[model samples]
Target: MRKSHAFLLYLALSGLCFCGLLAHGLFKKQADVEHLEAKCRLARTLQLTDMCLFTEASYTRHLSQADLHTAFQDYPMSLDHFPSGAIVPPPEIVRRTNGKVD
Candidate 1:
């Protein structure tokens, strides 16, 4: 009977620990969603792309049109977009009817 009581106590403690971990995960997920929503709102207000909605913990950054262009250009050359390889060449902008980038 004593052994059964100890086993039940151990099981109850394990269940409580599992519940705590689950609650922590839920809280973390909710925080992430809230963070993304805030980012999306900022993107809409700034006329930025939806790529601006996601934040990378490894490389947090404020979004800009030029930054988005640079990232897209770099993505093809990168291995997971880790920001540590093959530099992107400068864009060749020809923005006029006369093909003038200057």
Candidate 2:
């Protein structure tokens, strides 16, 4: 009878521990889902902003083209100049291995 009681006690403790682990896993999964949902919302907002910028750029380019054509017809001899002082050298690349740069 004592052996049977000890076995029952062990079974009950094991079952409780398993339940605790299962609850912890479910909670972690819920947190992960919430994090992913937040990221998805942020991505959607960024896409909408990018679409708006693209639309604005398209309109601006169309207006600029029309103005340039009108100006060319009115003054065919005008020339635009680029400033020579704006040139800059590109940066050199450095290689790295195992998170350390040599």
Candidate 3:
């Protein structure tokens, strides 16, 4: 009976350890996914900003008003402010607010 109890105790401990390891792995995977997602979001924002800036710079260099108009037509600029709903918080802003960019 004592040997049987020992066996049962060992089994329970092993099960508990397995559960702990599984939880740790899941937590790690979740953290990695969140980090990658943040990086992707930052990259997207940078791409959009770069495109807008490049288009604006191109528009500024034209010698003729007609050429400027033509360029502007090809790459239209929106004068409206970015909607709050659509704006992703920049990494810097996220860092400032959360004390970590996460």
Off by over 4 Å in 2: 38-102
TM-score of each: 0.35, 0.34, 0.34
Backbone clashes in model 1, listed as residue pairs: none
Put down candidate 3 lDDT per residue, 1-102, tens digits, no spaces. Answer: 699999999999999999999999999998899897887798797753232222233332221212323323434773323232123223333345446534
What's the count of clashing pairs in each model shown?
A: 0, 0, 0
Count backbone clashes in candidate 1. 0
- Candidate 3 has a TM-score of 0.34
| Candidate 2 weakest ten by summed lDDT | 85-94
lDDT of 1 by residue, 27-63 (tens): 9998899798998888789986435333552222333
Worst 10 residues of 1 by lDDT: 89-98
TM-score of 2: 0.34
Between candidates 1 and 3, name the one with more favorable lDDT: 1
Q: Write the residue-wise lDDT of candidate 2 on 45-82 in tens digits.
A: 77532222222233222332223232233367643222
- Residue 100 of candidate 1: its Cα lDDT? 52
Instruction: Assess each prediction's global lDDT (C-alpha) against the native.
Output: 0.55, 0.48, 0.52
For residue 30, model 2's alpha carbon misses the true position, in angstroms, by 1.4
RMSD of each: 10.5, 19.6, 15.6
